[model samples]
Target: MGLEFLDVFEQWANSYDESVGGQNREYKAVFAGYEQILEAVTERSMGHVMEFGVGTGNLTKKLLDKGLNVTGIEPSVPMRGIAEAKLGSKEIILDGDFLHFPDIINVNTIVSTYAFHHLTDKEKNEAIAKYGKLLSKGGRIVFADTMFESVEDYTNAIVKAREEGFHNLAKDLETEYYTTIPILRTILERSGFTVGFKRCNDFVWLMEGEKQ
Candidate 1:
């Protein structure tokens, strides 16, 4: 059995800003960590930096501020509009899911936050494989997201969510596509990217890869 649950990620498109899930000090810290990775890896700016699921331009604004030429792709129409307004980069951004793309073009470095878990397990694997092929050699890929060690871990997340004033609808997601450190490593390895992960805390982790 694979993942059958659908939270229909679009549900959060408009209301995300109001939700506690969207506003947090930890989230800002996570974004800063990604920026640190970007600064460390990106020695020379070549081609375009792309971020899948660029919601509301949180990280997008930071990257843009750093003078990085970025192209953002997003699935939710409302979210894409929000990102466009927030990012103010009309020409470089596109609105569509990564699956629809024939290939993710001009990607020298890819950064995604809280977006990878939105895909089904199979799709996640396939997307990683495609990402490997599309990226320029020696390109770095950075990601930050919430993941758990097990089902019990998700239960704990639910309790944490209760404190945050939302429900952990992702509890039924058992494929580890949503939360497995081991799977994160294996998928990237099989996809032809070198895998690395850093634990931010009990709830989140940063996964990085090199297109090799």
Candidate 2:
């Protein structure tokens, strides 16, 4: 679970939208083409969607607008509150993380954006395994997050962030649980998903995994 960052999310609740909108130069590249990334995730999702890390309900809104049934899960109280307020009383946004969500039914598609990296590689593997067991054949997982093509690329990204005087971005890169493509592919495949990745920007990539 990524609950260890609850305080960070609470603090970021108010400014998360602005930061993703490219207001924070240090994180601007990370969130480049923010709307398109959300749309990309939304476009891949269908039928009874369950969204993890629904921060501020941005992606939730898109899924809802697409006429998909969505249940949102957020670990941070303030973030959930903001998302609830934004999406209004009609939608259900629950308090949970990837591994600790309430039991949901008929969730054929799971979608998340810019949030899964909070989990360490081990946790990521566990989450994928859990989803593999929960989903039936043809169910899908669509996530857009900052992932590297390789460990060398991961290291280079941190170095570039540091060279650009993006100390916060560099520290975040080093501190968070960002992982490489091979590891994610291995985990998803081991868990029985046929997965694929598409670059969304310099930093983010869209990972779509269909359960087989």
Backbone clashes per model, in order?
A: 0, 0
Per-model lDDT: 0.64, 0.93
Per-residue lDDT of model 2, residues 1-212, tens digit only: 78888888998899999999999998899999999999999989989999999999999999999999999998888998899899885358988899998999888998899889999999999999999998899999999999999999999999999899999889889988999999999999999999999999999999999999
Error of 1 at 159 (Å): 6.6
Candidate 2 versus the native: TM-score?
A: 0.98
Question: Which pairs clash (backbone N, Cα, C closer than 3 Å) in model 1?
Answer: none
Give the number of the best model, judged by lDDT: 2
Tell me how many residue pairs clash in candidate 2: 0
Best model number under TM-score: 2
